[model samples]
Structure formats: C-alpha cells, structure tokens
Target: MPEANIADRFDLTNWKTESLRMTAFLSPGSPIPQQNWWEEICGSPPEVRSSQPRTGVQQDEGLFGDGNTQGRLILAVQPSRIDWLLTVEVVPTSFELPSVGSFSESANSFAQLMNRWLDVSPNLQRIAFGANLLLPFEDVEQAYQSLPAYFPLNKLDLKNAQDFNYRINRPRNVDYDISDLKINRLSTWSVMTFTAFQFTNVGSYTYSSAPLNVAIRLELDINTSIDFSGELSKDELPKMFAQLVEYAKEIALKGDIL
Candidate 1:
C-alpha cells in the first residue's frame, strides 16, 4: 500500500482561530460616528451598544451577532486617536485537519466586507488586518527533535538551545511587508508570530510525561496603507492571504530537516 500523505499523518487535535480585525486610521480633524459605522457594516442596527468617557476622550462600541452565535462582529471608535476598528471571529465545533481552501473562502469574504467598509468611509487612511491560529500537537517531543532534520546546519541551528526562538525577514522580490517574524518554544508549547506579507511555518517541541500535553500556536498579522484610487484590488488580497496560509501549513506538515 502507498504511504499516507504528510498532512494525513500529522494528526491535528484541535484548531482555533481568532477574529479578523481591520483598523483604520483617521486624521485629527476627522471623526467617525460609532453608531452609524456599526449600523452600516452590520447591515442593520446593532443589538447591543455602549459608550464610556475616559479622561478627555469618548469611546463607543457595538456588537452584532449572526443569530446562531457562530461568530460576531464588533465596531469600536476612539475619539482620542480618531480610529475605527472592526473585529470578526469564528471557531469550529469539533476537531479537524486544516484546510487551505476553507480558509481562503473565509478570508475572501472578510476582504469583501473590508472593501465595503472602505467604500463608506473615505476619511479612513491606512488599514491593517490580521488573524491567529492555535494548533495542538500530540507528539510534542518528537516534533521538536524533527526540526533539525528539516532545517539542517547553516540553514538552521539547534545546537545550543532546547527551546527555539528567532526572527526572519523576507528576502528580496517578496510582495508583502513582514515585520518581526518570531518563533518561540517553551516547555509545553511553541508559538510563531509574523505579519501577513506572506506565511511561513515555525514551531517548537517539549517533552512531557503522561498526563501532560503540548501544542503550537500561530499568530499572523498584515497591515498596509490602502490606495483608494484602486491600486489594491479585492480579488488580489484574499489570494495572497490564502497562499501565505497554505504555505505555512505545508512547511509544518511536510518540511524535512535533512
């Protein structure tokens, strides 16, 4: 019989993702009406809302739910910085393997929503968007030991440390801007964080006796100044995001140390 594919053998135990966030900067003189923006983005009046005054600034926030509660949309306005922020997040009900196509579809829908928000608020300056992934590993120690095989000598160093932590900048010709790509390993789990210019995979492992568990968490973020004149197209954003996400998964599942 043929060997199972790398992805099939990984044995993913759990997958969780944080909400997507879009933050728009505003000029000093320009301010957005929190209620209006929430109503517009949510396509109806918000079911819950609140306002509070702190120091010399006012804060307004609204929450919108999709009925069944699978996800939620949040809008927040800060008077001091003149910023408008939107957040949306979703999680699966059961354990499942990662799927790039599903992520692509979700990202595409998010991009479309962001585009709509941009259309309504011309005062919006630069926009930043991001997401996070949490993954649990069963064979944490074996996974950590395998790293040297996938990234050997000159390319990767595993000699001096039991825990791994480092940052990598993108090489030339890369289209996105990634700031501070970091990977850190602890006794129980590993974490990787980077901006969305593109996605790369990094992880660490720890040995624990029975009754102990370990996992890896991946956090991704991307932000860019939007070009309202049409330089940034909706179609391109999701595709780029999809490619970045898919590549990270491939590296985690198939990368070889040798």
Candidate 2:
C-alpha cells in the first residue's frame, strides 16, 4: 500500500507521540550474551540508562539512536521475568502529515537487527510484538463532541456523563489469541491533598494546578503473542504491523462501539 494512503486515513494534525515501541520476549533461561551486540548491529555503542521504579525490572538499558532515520532502539533485560526486550521509538518530523513509511522501515530494520542478534543466541524462544499510537487533541471537549460522527452510539449511553469518557477492550481474533485492541478516551485533571507531620504537629494542604491547553489523549495499544516453535521470519513482520495500523484506522472511522 502507498504511504500516503495510510497517512490520509488518520487525518493527522499537530500532535505528539510519547514513543512507538516494538518488543520481543525471549524464553526463560535464554540470556543475551555480554558481548558487543549493539556495536555489531547499530555500528555504535548505545547510551546506557537506568530502569524506573514502576517498571519493577531492575536492569540497565541500552539505547541507540539512528540520526539518519530519526529513530531509537532500547534493549533491556527483565530480571524478574527472565526475558529480554527490544523496543524501537520514532518521532514524526512533520506533524501535518506523518509518514507511515518511515515508521514501517524503522520497524523492518529493527526486525533485521533482532535476526542478527538471534544468530548467536539461538536458544531464545517465543516472540510477542505490538505497537502504540497516541493522538492528542488541543480541545478535548470538542474532540469528545466529534466522536458520535464516527462511532455508532446506539449501544452506548451517551447521557450517562456530561463530560464523556469511555473505553472498549476486546480481542480482535480469538484463534490467534491477539488482544488488548482498544479504543478509549483519556483526560488530565488535578487533585487536592492534605498532609500531616507527626514530629512538627502541623498540617498542610496543597492543590495541583488546573490543566491548561493539554490535549485529550486517544490511545490504541495492539498486541499479539506467538510461540517461538513456529516459523519466525522478518519478511512478514512489517506487513503485519501495517495491517494493525489499518485495523486501528478502520475502528476509528467505522467501528460501532463507543
């Protein structure tokens, strides 16, 4: 399919993406070698970083940047689960019309990089892949108002809430065990809290600032897991991802669910 065809489907405007991640889960006891894997695949050493507390995985992460492609690769070891993960994140240069081709090419390159790494560590088993698309709106109220035009609201109780926020989580195909395909509305708000100190015998109250022009976020996370015992090929990886992107667009344009 032509790149412009995919780009036009979203009717994208000025927007920001947190990151686009593609991950592979290795079977237990299959550890990556301590050699120069990044240097061999990326032609340079990756910038190292630490894991966050929320991730629950205490491991150093290797990050590589491709200036030519404007993409990044993150490789991290999950000690808790005995798995290794490889993630690729790419930022769009032109917000007016983001190029899906660039993202696809980057994903294909990442798959090739993984294939090279697998050459040395052949014991690794099982592979699961997924992507996330985050679209932000400048006026969340207006964005919410426009949802009815796309989704069929007959099954949805729109009057239940004044400021509408809804979510749908369902499997795309049961036989493949593919899941986490969702369409939802998200918002940002503030909260007030009070704190008390025992030693000082004093109490204090605080309130967060009201959110400004931050846009309402619409997130779609699609995932699929497969057993490693089956055939693994990089040729079809990009095609599968493209299909997922198209599926997401179809949902936004013609899905019946709210």
Relative to the true structure, how large is the alpha-carbon lDDT of every model? 0.41, 0.40
Clashing pairs in 1: 149-256, 149-257, 149-258, 150-256, 150-257, 151-257
What are the per-residue Cα lDDT tens digits for candidate 1 across 111-183?
5665666666645333445544444445455435434432322344333335454333221122543332221
Worst 10 residues of 2 by lDDT: 185-194
Clashing pairs in 2: none
- Models 1 onward score TM values of 0.50, 0.49
Per-residue error (Å), model 2, residue 159? 7.1
lDDT of 2 by residue, 62-111 (tens): 65444333334565555323233334343432223222223334444445
Q: Candidate 1, after superposition: displacement of residue 240 in Å?
A: 11
Clashes of each: 6, 0
TM-score of decoy 2: 0.49
Using TM-score, give the best candidate's number. 1
